[model samples]
Target: MDSPKGPTEWAEGRHGVGPWEGPWPDDPRFDPTLLAEGDRRNVVDAYRYWSLEAIRAELDTRRHPFHVAIENFENDMNIGTVVRTANAFLAEAVHIVGRRRWNRRGAMVTDRYQHIIHHDTVGDLVAWARGRGLAVVAIDNTPGSVPLETATLPERCVLVFGQEGPGITGDTAAAASMTCSIAQFGSTRSINAGVAAGIAMHAWIRQHGDLSRAW
Candidate 1:
């Protein structure tokens, strides 16, 4: 049988002036297939040369049950990082509370694969989570919060996080079913919001997702 060539092979070789400069760099960081095409921004193996909208449509079909919510009142760049992490984890959706416009530079277009919703305030986020039958689990370092490692994460829960400096607001805390914290003995008061979100997301995956899904 002849080789199973696809349209992608033709699209890869075509490039615009500044859009995707001359020849793809020979650096090991660049995939050989991508080099043949053009464009050099890190993305999943299946996404190279695929239009952003195409990748997003495929991701939408495989989205997970868990959702991620973040406070963007302060316009913290961590929100973008959180969205990127959520895309990698295949979260069901991302909820942004307080601000509609956030820094998308760090997301590096990963948001296109992730479902993002904007809410006016913490109350709106709480209501949305409740309507979806999702438990609102807040990640913060509070007195009664349990260690995230030992907590029994819900399968269909919304993992909510706050900005770096202020932590979660009082209203958000009150809206949550429970608040969980990462155990630490270091001098730092808490962990980065983006890192904390990823850890929490993985924890949920461990508790409910199928083991074979890891591969």
Candidate 2:
């Protein structure tokens, strides 16, 4: 379940280090087995031998105020990619609307370190966000959508995305406080949900994230 801690999968040097050189540090965050057998869990240097719980705990403490939600109708494969990117961005949480089972293969195990919530319907999702004073900002190329590049994203909001092809349902779009659309010059009708989520999340980061903390 390990795949580096904190930021994105910019894990360089895929090969991990050898066993402990001397006495291991007295830290509960480290995994004894990993220290003895050497850490080759495809993680970054900063989280070399840290236990899964340790990484999860650390990420929870510093997760951004923004959240990411994806409509999972028809078992969208893009959900995984969205999750992986969310972990990289350190979003507060990820919400899965509709079906519970989504293709995790694209996530590359990043979901293990990220927090995920399941909503039975769009109404449920919207209610949850509003109850917590978080704005629901949907992403889609629907009519009258604001250009995301220049929009002022809410500091504490849930950036919602829809599956590719059909895109977001009319109800979902109507329920959002505001809908944002990414600018595109290509011939394609619209980009996939996963790519849109990444763009939207980065936009929020640009507005509220602390650059010095990025790793």
Candidate 3:
């Protein structure tokens, strides 16, 4: 095995293995091209030089039961960030409602490892969730919304988020089994959609995720 490279070197895109320093390991997960040319992709050390498919397969074995859904009514820029955060939390999958295409820049290619499904409308997403016996939990700040800090998130549920400014549509909210709001101390009326998604996912992790499995 080659010596581990420094973070600065990797950031500069000048790090990673440069051909096999010794007899190559027999692991089939390692990509020959990445091993020879150096893998500069943004990935954990456990997955260094591993093929994309291999990494995704490993993630699938431990992904949480919770799913994430975002509304893409107007090319919402925050959708990608939500997907990226879902990957970080190892969400079961991501559902996009309203639009098929979303900005991928924020996802930083993590979407390749995350399973994504599209729904033509909120009703379709609700139907899919019901069919799977998964509850729909909406994250939004509105009248009668329970504070997330005090709420009990469903272990197997789809967290639904709305567009950047409009928030959860009435139709979407009607479908949710419960609506949760992150408690805020500041004067801001609401947090960014991406940030809210991360908080909501973390809330789920705190309640039900296997902490021993986290790296």
Candidate 4:
């Protein structure tokens, strides 16, 4: 990407570049509006002026096999943050269980580039994964759960997260092929669902994803 913005962008406290200084590239991926005006979206430099569809199409080619699921019975605010994290890690899709609507404020607009699917119940999510031959890994610090730090995650799996406060339901844990818990030494009994999801996704990345492919 061309470092087109510098002092002026900083002075205005705006993000991205402002218009094309020279002849616009003859690429179909670039958005006409973005090229004529500017791109202020929360996107990478490589995709600065690209249309939303173009960026999404490009991302679809490289998304990882692993999926992410969140229990949204309580309309958790952390769901958006989890979506943002999943977008960053390039997960195959995000499955929302128990609810169709969720808060989008925490996602910072990244949801437009991420795939989201809704399940009516936890059992539906598990059955869907099983039908596709994908392992379901529940993430919570419940009893007898294996520590995520030492466990080897499957290359193709779904990492399910429960809502904050209540954590994973017993049914959700029971449906999972395995339950992995994060280690914590602090006084808090559990961590935020968003933070936990990020850790778990990174664990999957460390296990099977190629670091060199990341930006």
Per lDDT, what order, best first? 4, 3, 2, 1
TM-scores of all candidate predictions against the true structure: 0.79, 0.92, 0.93, 0.93
Worst 10 residues of 1 by lDDT: 9-18
Q: Encode model 3's per-residue lDDT on 97-183: one tens digit a residue.
A: 998988898998889999999999999999999999999999999999999999999999999999888999998899999999999
Instruction: Give me the runs in candidate 4 sitting further than 4 Å from their true place.
Output: 1-14
What is the lDDT of every predicted structure here?
A: 0.81, 0.89, 0.91, 0.92
Clashes of each: 1, 0, 0, 0
Candidate topping TM-score: 4
Q: Is candidate 3 or candidate 4 better by TM-score?
A: 4
Model 4 lDDT per residue over 33-135, tens place: 9999998776778899999999999999999999999999998889999999999999999999987889898898989999999999988999999999999
- Report the C-alpha lDDT of model 1 over 1-215, residue by residue, as the tens digit: 75554433234423221233576555443445445555544454445655666667777777789999999898878988898889878899999999899989878677877889999999999998899899999999999998999999888889999999799999989988989999889999988999899899888877886767542
Give residue 149's lDDT in candidate 3 (0 to 100).
Answer: 97
Residue-wise lDDT of candidate 2 within 17-121, one digit each (tens)? Answer: 788789899999999998999887655678989999999999899999999999987888899999989998999999999999988989888899999999999
**Decoy 4 TM-score against native:** 0.93
TM-score quality measure for candidate 3: 0.93
How much is 51 displaced in model 3, in angstroms?
A: 0.4
The best-first sequence of candidates by TM-score reads 4, 3, 2, 1
